[model samples]
Target: MSISPDSTNQRRRLPGSDAPAQAPSGRGLPRHLLGKLATTPTHPAITVGETLLLPLLAVVLGLAFAPQDPLLTQAAFPWPWLVPVVLALRYGPLAGLGGASVLLACWLGLNVGHWDVFPQLYFLGGLILVMLVGEFSSLWQARARRAETLQLYLDQRLEHLVRQHYLLRLSHDQLEQELIARPMSMRDALKELNQAGQDAHGAGPTPQQLLRVLSQFCQLECAAIHPVRDARPQAQPAAILGACDGLKADDPLVQQALRTGQLCHINQAVSAQQDTLYLVAAPLVDLAGDMYGLLVVRDMPFFALQQESLQTMQLLLCYYTDSLSMQRLAQPIVSQVADCPPRFAFELQRLAHMHRETQVPSVVVALEFRPQALKQDLPEQIMRLRRELDEVWPIEGPERQVLAVLMPLGTSGTAEGYVRRLEAWMQHRSQQSLAEAGIFTHVLPLDGAAPLRTVERLRAIAHA
Candidate 1:
């Protein structure tokens, strides 16, 4: 899951540009003012609090600042005029009118039974002005708030769409890399096969090894590699190779893929009246382009959007089958040689252990090489090798650690010989580069009887 440089750059820009539409209005408001506004409740309680506070403050100020004159009293009758207006703007016309009524009542109570003391016309006029202003302000504020809310919603939707688009793109890139990596695995397998072909005697992968590789590459729940038998299509069941979960060889999709030499996509299948959806099947074609058997995959949920991805995966599987065929053609030649590295020998021993334990024919092989030379002299060699290997063989583990190699399913007898050829090639290269560079080679035995502890094994090898 390495992020592309472009994606990394996009992520960097995301934090700064998030909610760009809201930026303008948000920036316009002072931080303290925005904070206070946010805390202000949307209920009428806020309006009531404002009305009570403003009038009381205004009356206190008036008593201290203004002389007790009849003219001043008349002018100051609507002393807390701003309170009702604020209440109306925040809580609507009804709230403003109610607040004004309460203030008016309070004023009348103070000047009750004293018509001469209070100018009734002036007081009435002040109350009417407050109500009018409050209502008008409230109407404008309500409209503004509605528009703002609509704009915010639109912005959110737009951002969501943009993020989805980005995720899709990211997923596409990942798929491409996975597809590209497949061929590289095949190429590595081919390299082993080619060397085996040239060596006159070597060993090669077994069917079980191939199945394990396929399972790893496809991220399958289980993989069954069956030998095509000349029996009635309906009667023969595919053989189970490497499986993460327990699945019968007689599964419908598995049987279909084996019989037809065609990829089967089982969207759903009924198992005990339970409809199970999302499955894929692919055919294994050897290097000679001969259809061997079907690669049955189950329990994977496929979406419409993942059609292209699934198709690509199928292509990779086909390529793997072809590479396996090529390796088979080269195996007899390589098997005659007994000379291989200790690591390769250890792998062979492990494969022997698995064969005895599981009663399944399997073998382990290793490709030893100097990565630095490949990187320096053949800059595109890695990519080339990746493309080739992925076509025929799926990688067992991390690509960074192992170059390209194939583990053909159901392979036996000559696996060690195939590994020996690869070892000899590495030795030749190491000797050739000894004058100018330190050349080191490491062998990894896949399908060994011991558990495939990738990190620990690689670490031990590096230290060794």
Candidate 2:
């Protein structure tokens, strides 16, 4: 059966990555193949001279030793029979009987002058024995050859089944991801928000409208809104309402919400950060997976963390994200690149979360380079290091020099081996250690965060 490589995610090795060849499965050679497979272990050949050499020698010896009298021919000597038996084992029944006939003729010719019943009987008995041996050898070889053929056929079938299995699994994963991309409930929620936005007829901005809903209907005070598309890190302040009026993207509360993709609440009652800013924080992301910003709240004596409040915030934030995505879609393409990071990071974060649930010993490693520009040769270098199951993404800026490598199904040992190779390569290229070259790695779970969060946290650490 024919199989397409794509149908089973055919794995190809990149340059510089070496893998050993697979070992042969079958053990001993089948009997049919053994006779002709090779002349000897070290001297492999199938010359015609070699095949006839022993049989020809046997024939010469038999002729020279033949008796000239009937009395001598009566003795059943086995020397003359050896040639026919050897031929029978190697060339099968036809050659065996033919050789026996030749020996019989030689004996008859040499002893014709003193011919008797004893010589005739002796020739007949030897011919019959040689013929039987030839027939048995021929049948045994045919059966062995057929067995070898059947083994090969079964091995091919097993390979095809394995490919089909991988194809099915890949299809299953794709379907699951599509379902996760946009759930029906999230779609319905966005539809209602779109209807509301149309009815209002641009009476006010969507972000301001969302903020108003949280303050009045949701009973949340000290709230703020930040549009992710217009994110300026710590350079710009988010729109504010109460005590959390000056909260920016750099605030620990907002970072926590963005990192975890959850509504983070600061337990100020414990007084850990005596310089407390916000008490509640949530991120806004649409069903289409576009991230808008954070909704942070602080200093509300009556406000407290509850499941009902968290759910309310989630719905409100999703509506705001939908409104913002529509706004950006109306803008020109050139202005779109600046807005793509958060949305991309958002989607990647969701995928990372899904991957984390599997707990399949995955690892994410970051490679840092100085001057915020990768060398032209770096892509080739990185590709060589990558496996078929890996994902590589550039992070940390418009001029992202920090590369993150996600190794799916990687064990701790695998990670360590990869790191050693990387270090060796780096030392060879730049003659500098990783730290001296402004290169570093942030292995996943080392920072106790998801891959995307770990990247963001790593970026934050680098800047600090």
Find the candidate with the highest TM-score and give its number: 1
Per-residue CA lDDT of model 2 for 1-464, tens digit only, reads 42232422222321111331122356786556855663333332432333445545665665566534322344446565677776777667776776766665555665567455545566677678778888888888777665554444344334334433443443355455424532323333445555666566422246666665566545666777765654333324357676553655566666656665555555421233534467676677554444667677775544334433454456556446644554444222213233223333432343354344433345667676555225444644665777644556665544446666666446667777877887797789878666665666666642223443455554653343
Q: In order, what lDDT does every prediction score?
A: 0.45, 0.53
TM-score of every model versus the real structure: 0.32, 0.28
In candidate 1, stretches whose alpha carbon ends up further than 4 angstroms from where it belongs are: 1-40, 67-71, 76-78, 171-175, 182-464
In lDDT terms, how accurate is model 1? Answer: 0.45
- Candidate 2, pairs of clashing residues: 228-292
TM match of model 1 to true structure: 0.32
Give per-candidate clash totals. Answer: 50, 1
lDDT of 2: 0.53
Cα error of candidate 2 at position 408, Å: 31
